[model samples]
Target: MKLWLGTGLVEEDVAGVSPLDRGFTLGDGLFETLRVKGGRVLRLDAHLARLAAGARVLGLPLPAFDFAGALRATAQANTLAEGVLRLTLTRGTGPRGVLPPAHPAPTLVITAAPLAPPAPPARLSVAEGTRRNDRSPLARVKSLNYLDNILARQEAAGRGTDDAVLLNTRDRVAETSIANLFAVLGGELVTPPVSDGVLPGVMRAAVLAEGARERSITPAELATASEIFLTSALGLRSVRSLRGRELPGFSVAEHLRTRIDGA
Candidate 1:
């Protein structure tokens, strides 16, 4: 029951709480898991933007946070190592009612652990995804409620794949379990637009911005691409070796691999 509530780090006794906390009882919270590297977080600003966006989605009054200071503290708490950095902000203990309290204090916790990058991905596996409706408010928020992703991950594992590429109800590619998907058709890198029911991932946004700057992605030209790839804070970038029975790799993938590897 150790927790990081507000600015001070405290154990359960000091923090003083009950077992029926709203976050524990109803998953009333939001969180972000970042991959830390080089004493910095990848695409830190983008993560903050997403966090704010998620708060808005949940109708939660976000803590007036010092974004940079938290990163510095998290880096120190975590040390310089390849690992996961997670920040969870829960609307603090509340009474038994569906209506949220007027003056709610947020409970904040940052978790960190060591990590080692995975071996170069030889292939990306595709599995069925939970068809999330466009109106589902949670889709836009990275909330503590993750039953959808949990079930999706479990099904993906049984399908004998590394990860699942979730699709929208329109059958368009949404994203992966924990990453964003990009495809190259006609030598132009293409990814599903954010409006097409996918989280605007920080790393994904960074790569797209970079590619656009380099004139690598041409708008609305990805449907004719030669290959498809995925990226995340941890994965960074990996090309899909095969899609179903079709071999989707291209010479461009090799080139992109070189470019991303060099980064």
Candidate 2:
């Protein structure tokens, strides 16, 4: 497969990033996973806006290039009609300490892959291992440091579930390992606020714009939810069960799916 590297496309085998790159060595980078449908990258503007936000947070200078063109080139080069695009930007190689180098050159890589088949209804468990650090600035940025999420997902797998819901330091619902959480609580669609360690997902924004409210949710409240769902760049998936309690309603997810797909 071909991938976009910095300013042009290159064969995957030949594309290289220095092992000393901070993104690989220290997880000092940002990434976006974008969906491509019918050869179009969906929500390009929103994705770029979010990327800019992350760059600002990290104080990293973005590469001076055609971001949209590069994304389109990667997808087109791969002949991707329905698939995903992952854009990774890093601070490049740095000195031997935690402090980044002055006048750093950022590395930009964009890769495309076919979309996986629709996921099955998710089975979730509350993570017991790690909690999302809502107080950390990185919590709001889609950065490369994902060990906490990885641990939670590992915990879920060990518990025989598809994913895990990560709570914040305050023990409030934050989000699932890979998606934003939404529930029909008291018959109103709601998701956790970004202040609660939520990543401010692009699809989550789309859902919120459709009138889903944002608020703090407790574990007890989550248990009483009539329907639950997850939102990510790919789309929405209804929750089959949470913590072993069966949640069998998909109407809200399906309705939102229809609306999003039509958008």
Candidate 3:
């Protein structure tokens, strides 16, 4: 397989990252996952805009490179007509300490993989171990620090579920470990606002544009939702159950999928 390393595309085996890279050592970096269909990248501008937003938050300067061209090249090189592409950007090598150097060279890597088969309807569990920090700036940034999400996912696995629902520090529904959460509450589709520790997912924005309202949702409210679904760069997925209680409706998810896919 081939991948795009810093400078240009290189053989995956020959590609390397320095041990001193801040992204590896301290998780100081940002990444964007994109979907490519029919050899065309979906929402390329939005993904790059989000990446640029994250870079500003981290005070990380983006390198002078054609990120879009690189993405296309990587996908084409891998012969991936339909697949997922990931662009990872990190503050290159740095010395010991949390303080980043004044001048830093960013490390960028883009890789492509064949799209996995569609997953079954998800079963979710509420994460009891950790809470999303709504007040932190990082909550809105897609940074490299994913330990919290990993923990929640592990907890869900232990419960024999597909994913975990994370509540904010104030106990309001935020999102799932890997996707934005949307539920049909009282006949209205609602997803938590970014202020509620949501990640402002690329697909989430697209769903919102479809008329889903943004508001704060409580745990109690979530349990009574008529329908629930998850949105990520990969696509929309309906929830089969939450806490072992079967959810009966996926009409909303289906409709949105049809509309979005057609668009």
What are the per-residue Cα lDDT tens digits for candidate 2 across 112-179? 99999999999999999899999999999999998999999999999999999999999899999999
Off by over 4 Å in 3: none
lDDT of 3 by residue, 1-263 (tens): 99999978999999999999999999999999999999999999999999999999999999888999999999999998889999999999999999999999999999999999999999999999989999999999999999999999999999999999999999999999999999999999999999999998999999999999999999999999999999999899999999999999899999999988524
* RMSD of candidates 1 onward, in order: 4.5, 0.8, 0.8
Give candidate 3's whole-model lDDT: 0.95
CA-lDDT, candidates in order: 0.64, 0.94, 0.95
For every model in order, what is the number of clashing pairs? 6, 0, 0
Residue 144 accuracy (lDDT) in model 1: 90
As for model 2, its CA RMSD to the true structure in angstroms is: 0.8
Cα-based lDDT at residue 148, candidate 3: 94
Error of 3 at 35 (Å): 0.6
- Which pairs of residues have clashing backbones in candidate 1? 184-225, 184-226, 185-224, 185-225, 185-226, 186-225
If both were scored by lDDT, which would come out higher, candidate 1 or candidate 2?
Answer: 2
Please state the error at residue 214 of candidate 1 in Å: 16
Off by over 4 Å in 1: 1-5, 10-18, 122-126, 212-225, 239-263
TM-score of each model, in listed order = 0.80, 0.99, 0.99
RMSD (CA, angstroms), candidate 3: 0.8
lDDT-better candidate, 1 vs 3: 3
